[model samples]
Target chain A: MITIFGKPLLLLYGQLTLGLINGAFYALLSLGLAVIFGLLNIINFAHGALFMLGGFVAWALLEYLDIGYWPALVLAPLIVGVFGVVMEKTLINRLYKLDHLYGLLLTFGCALIIEGLARNEFGSSGVPYPIPDELRGPLDLGFMMLPAYRAWVVVAAAGVCLATWLVIEKTRIGSTLRAATENAPLVQAFGVNVPRLITLTYGAGVALAAFAGVLAAPIYSVNPNMGANFIITVFAVVVIGGMGSILGSIVTGFGLGILEGLTKVYYPQASATVVFMVMVIVLLARPAGLFGKA
Target chain B: MPMSRRALLATAAATALPVRPARAEKPTLKIGVLTDLSGPYKDLAGPGAVDAARMAVEESGLAAKGINIEVLSANHQNKADVGASVAREWYDRDGVDIILEVANSGVALAVAGVTKEKNKVYINSGAATSDLTGAQCNANTIHWVYDTYMLAHSTGAAMVKTGGDSWFLIVADYAFGHALQRDSTDFVQKAGGTVLGAVRYPFPSTTDFSSFLVQGQASGAKVLGLASAGTDVINLIKQAHEFGIKMRIAGLLIFLTDVHSLGLEVSQGLTLTESFYWDLNADTRRFADKFARRQPGRRPTMVHAGVYSSGLHYLKTVGDMGLAQARADGAATVARMKATPTSDDCFGPGSIRADGRKLCPAYLFEVKKPSESKGPWDYYKLLATTPADEAFRPLSASACPLVKA
Candidate 1:
């Protein structure tokens, strides 16, 4: 019976719950971007395409290999991760010394090629991926019926995000990786295989993106262009969270998603622009982003 | 690849007669085909739309009349400014006699404005805004194929007739979505159905629609009317399936390509409307067979069929009027097009109204169950077919200035 700003209270609760579910994806995706940019200093523009590749790989695995969601969740990322490593070794490794724009351009070209190939293989109308049986139904969560898959998305994404943060911020290897980003030659002098670390870091970042893609495959219409839809928004999330800041991206991703959800409820017309609008304000207020170090 | 497809059309067309225009309109009749070549709509109205126009030119038999008919195509990329600039360039620089396809509603409307200013013919098959035939209607432009009014009246009335007494609309926030929702609301309300509420989501960006779906479920609306198109509709259906929300989901303006993407399982039992379907009848089948050969593994949607039919009618008018006059005066050419009844391999025989609106039969189809589909593109099972006279908006209701009270 209660109303908030002329809308029902139940509506706000329901939108907030749904917002958290969507925030899981933004958090998951931006975390990967944060890790890749934070450690490698390569603005991986192909991240979106790679994310799309992840969903396709899951679809392909299920379609061709009869690998269900459970295994493809593990296998798709592994396959896409290895491809990322190969890309790093062959092409991306060549651009470490160049300006950041070169890395961005190369990756952008990579995104186009990858998207084109996927489009050629699978037409843009998008193929459907079934929700896993375990998470198929909705939970009658009093105020609203929440899909179990959505609940799973939020939990799984949060777990992975926390694990990634712990590994990057708390562990010895993560500390060494961070050291390498600060001064690569100095980290190499300390005998900690810096090039291999960079390669692995890119692989891990790509793996995280693929993982999000796997989580998203069941939710979004599994298509080549699906990743392109979110990549720019995810990039906005990363910038708002403080680019290259792991905690910043993870926190800001969820915050912006909930903000976007509320925008959908209040001013649906401005829902699309709400995130970018926040980005402009945040950047003006704090150029380094919400959590980035100046 | 193209040779084989052309061979297929050539072999088939050898038996039929082209509506021979008595004389040449101009030495060269260059028809520009502008559409969304590389965006979300590319599958429905991109390259396929251009191919449809090409077929129309070829089938019009304008070539055999020693009239050099050239079809030039460009991708608007779903941008309004880009489409307007392209229209200006095509008319002013390339000497294009008329433009066809003009796919996205926003882009098509933008190009419509330019077409009026430049005094060039524009036949639209892609956009759904009835405003083209309503407020924005112009002598220089012909609103072809289907519009939001027909889609809403057909699908909305169908759903309401089937005991969907309460409705909730999940709309894409844009002019097209707004028009569809507005028109659909009219039909729903007129048919004694109450609209519970509606949600407008930012389009081409807010793909995850679970939030909106939850709101729809909580509202207790019997039917969830999706006043959005393309991937947005597909995403809503797919997610609604996952959530197992039992509200009847009705997609107002679903293309065959959209049904193809969603597959029979997720999209099954959804009643929708279309002006053209490749499997409608022998005429469409024969024409679609050649069109499928050109696109390869793809069936033509209504937009493509509209392009084919509209192109044929335009070229025929130009042929009748002569090149100099048709090219010099777009309004006269459009008047001539309206004066003649349209007969094509697609929509068969139809007539154009004074407001530059093309009238034809509209079909209501249910997406067949996976078990019912015989093969690929065997997606629709016809529920009903409205005759040409009743399929579109009546002339009395039109808001075009050309229409008298």
Candidate 2:
């Protein structure tokens, strides 16, 4: 059996671990996407650009100012969040009452403009962000050697994903936000300042993407086009997980990453297209996703 | 007698004064810098090539002459169709006399076809496929800079010679990756290495490589060659580290830009072959220093360096004569460049081969350990220098139609 399978157990475990790491990013990005989709009902094509901007912000902080990772972590999200707020107020809000497609289009245009400006300014080559001193080395875990930074990324992303889910699922503010999303007129009658809440919500969602970007900067090259590369995969992940459920998105994100990892081991050629292929299968078999509320 | 002498002088002046000055109209030489200005390949070509072109113009002092030179640029978006259309437009309408820096192989091939049709010149520095000079070779196109055959021969053959044979390839499932794998395999086998096994990863894949690494680890091959670049290279290295597949991993064609991006931790101890390094020699240092003054903190890539050399050669030819004369004098100009021991700010004293490949010494470099000290960008330790003759695929081995003919 072992001879026929060629170390199937080890391969599967390795693939799953890889999948979980990828899923962590997927979960974080999709969670943000879901939050925005739930309220704004816009695709937010610029989400990836914002994520890339977050990474660039972190890189700039380190490269130009000698600010460490801890500070950059806090500063990058805040800076990106502010940009998000400006983007929402100046551009996104204008398209709210119009066709939802306009919001998508506007965000898409904003994404192109942002990516173009960054590429023009920085060029397409990736800039390196040093791993923080605290998370520089590898930790031996019997079967595998895990880099402290990658492990941190997986954990930190999960923590953020869970905390966001908790906030949305529980708490009075969460209920009010949900109410606004379902029926903004009623929430406004309750004197909740629904418009302000919506604006903040969009900003918060963008902030999540930026946060992920900041985490990814040290691991991946801080390139202008970094977000564009992963955004399509995240969209496919969101589709597979079903955009309707937050938890589903999280599970699917991590789940697919592992599946992709396994594909790499067993059938390397199909590794790249496996996720999209899975998305197709899920859409055909269970349209609402595995953990979705259908 | 005085009146007669004055008449004679007036007659001499009248004969000396030229009648057809309009026939010697200053020729405007249009050179197209086809680069990815706003796409994934942009950093690899784009503005850097533009800057190189400007440097060439300045270095050649072409503007000082009566010749008028103009440079135009476009982004092909890594698509052959787009590149073809742009090349056609530039050739037919825009009067682009020469096209340089077609980055993507697909795009390069497309532009090569168009240049052939238009009877224009192409100096390809960006594309990696040897097929441009091989099966796809055209009289109008010159494959400058490095190609897959050079990379495969330099890295693969060198590794095999050093006894790091028995290969496992983690190839990107694309034309570029496939060709690289095929070419490298031939060199590996010829150098007395065995191909243990191989696998292909999808292009632009965003996932962990734990599985692929495990398969490679299980292959038991002394060398695991990564036939990929950019994000795939980054992810593979990182994931390979995680999976503990650190022994004898080889990057067939990794850019210094990629090494800079990956940093020391991910890139450390990995060996790769490169035609140009910023810190190669005194001339390179001078060129890189000047480049840094403009770019500020970023290093000049090989493609950028190639652009400067090719552009300068073009301008020099045009300056010596006119655009038509320069184009006609291609062989002579190329020979002159080869005859002169070429020294530049980027690569010092590299010779251009007859087959249009730049024959500079390649370096086998190992990524420096984090503790090796220094600071950021202090990444590589020169393991061995493969000389110009030894570094590239021999003329006899080249399938380039030009070489065969």
Candidate 3:
């Protein structure tokens, strides 16, 4: 309840943390988008829908099979990743020889069909997913109380994002993967099995989205329209972060989330629009984006 | 005198095609339940509303009277243009006599305009905008259930009396949200309370409301007003509870369905205003019990109850007037409907006003605590009842031309 000019600093910290929590999601989601776009040279327009599907899968596992949250956290991503593999092999693999727009359109259409089917089955008032029993209460800081689950979301998301960055940047497998993106035929000539790598990369990218979805289920109720709500804002995050830079995506996601939170406290009404405004400003100023290579 | 055989044959064939008679037996009246069956309002009004109407028609025994009634339904998808188009097709091509259960205010208003132009009746049970009977009022539309004004007035006045003085609002940014804010602000001010601060979130888009809640919490207001409905209201309440906001939350428009979605643990002690509650009395419970048999595991919200009440009243009026006469003139049918008293097991005895607002008592309900052990769907405890005359805006205050005339 620390007040500066009648504005509570605790309230400000709470909002910033909330923003950071949202940014954690943004960071995770944009990282997946950037990763998929980097190797596949195609935007996974269905990434958001996959994220939503992850939540439903987790919910279904809990509701139907009596499986708990901890297992579903791991299982949901694996299931969605396999689904992404199948999608890449059967549908998306054919479009690689065509224009990039075909890939975009094909994935966009896939997203719509998936969302429609989910809506038809679930009907849109979201089913609530309760917080895990251990994480039910809030942490009592001297100044303010923060929900334990939300704090975990930020910390866990940052860990995952950093781990993903390290896997791509400092590993031997990452070099080969980057090489395949630059020259698939050359990489294949070097006996790297580039086509299989492409499929697996897409799967991994989609799995990242599903992972975020599982994390998000308890925060936002599981609903068909959940993905559509964040997809546009996430796209803005990707654009501002640069489409192919992993670190850039993570930084930009968290930064914009915090900025949006600050805006909510200071101006309130412009919070939703602020992220997109920053996107526009960034695009106009640096066409290649903050971390994008020309 | 020498008429050709070809001419005689042509005249005979023309008469064989069956000319429509100037005076015919009464045709079946078609009622369309156009509402959101797939979007956010689906659980609030969707198929339950349709089932409620069917139940009303079944109970009316109109079939025994040699009067046939048909119920047609479609999913409006919560879009205004789509609702307008559905209303047009129902009225013009399908011969649907009246439309009911319009849920979204934007869509409801659009359908209201369509009804006016097409000379058809629209009984709005799900939408909550007073403008339907106020500035945007039409001769062809009856705002059957609750409206934002009634809710704001009931909830605001009650909270103010209970010592929740200053307020902050997290409003959904839309027509319905704006109307609720405006109406509630007026009531709060009149009750000698002040609105400290407020924020508007994009309707249905901002799934996260933590920032908004923090702002409200920081406002140091005694009461926090949730001027949103459906999942938005449910989510905000759950988050606020987790954050441990000490302010008394006044939920302006919360349906029973929302409470059911959020269990008693999170929803307990929430004060809201509703026109009808299933567990209110014997009549309401009886109707609700019967509705449960049809829906199976789902309880009736006020909107669902509104559909039944309005549907039954409409059928009774049509039966008395004869379907043919009712269909011949839409305005006259509506006028006759206004003249009749609205009595059903759901709402009990009520009546419609000149501005097409259905007059009924509204109740202030507090959600039952978890320790108050009860069976499923046992949610509310009645706190106060605002009588029919005081529950809504006065006719003299309405900007409707019909009210003025």
Q: If you assessed candidate 1 against the hidden native complex, which CAPRI class would it receive?
A: medium
Q: Residue B118: error of model 2 in Å?
A: 1.0
TM-score of each: 0.92, 0.88, 0.93
lDDT of 3 by residue, A195-274 (tens): 89999999999999999999998877688888988999998998898888999999999999999888877776677889
Candidate 2, A191: how far from true, in Å? 1.5
- lDDT per residue for candidate 1 within A1-294, as digits (tens), equals 999998798889988988887788899999999999998888888999999999999999998989999999999999999999999999999998999999999999999999988876777778878888888777888887788888999999999999999998899999999899999999899898999999999999999999999999988988889889989999999999998999999998898889988887888778778899999999999999999998
Candidate 2 Cα outliers beyond 4 Å, as residue runs: A1-4, A64-67, A139-141, A286-294, B1-25, B238-245, B264-268, B319-321, B327-355, B367-382, B403-405
What candidate 1 keeps of the native contacts, as a fraction, is 0.76
What is the two-chain DockQ of model 1? Answer: 0.60
Can you write out model 1's per-residue Cα lDDT over B1-405, one digit (the tens) per residue? Answer: 457987889888986767787975558889999988777888888888889988988888778877888889998988999999999999889999798988789988899899889888999998999989888889888988899999998888988888998999999888888998899999999999999999888877888887788778888999999999888888999988887889998899899999898888888988899988898889999999999889988999999999988998998888898877998988889999999999987898989989888998888999999999998899998998888778778879888888954
Task: Assess each prediction's global lDDT (C-alpha) against the native.
Answer: 0.89, 0.80, 0.89
Error of 2 at B13 (Å): 46
* lDDT digits (tens) for residues B153-269 of candidate 3: 999999999999899999998888999999999999999999998899877778789888877877799999999988788789888877778899999999888888677888899
- Provide the lowest-lDDT 10-residue window in model 1 chain B: B17-26
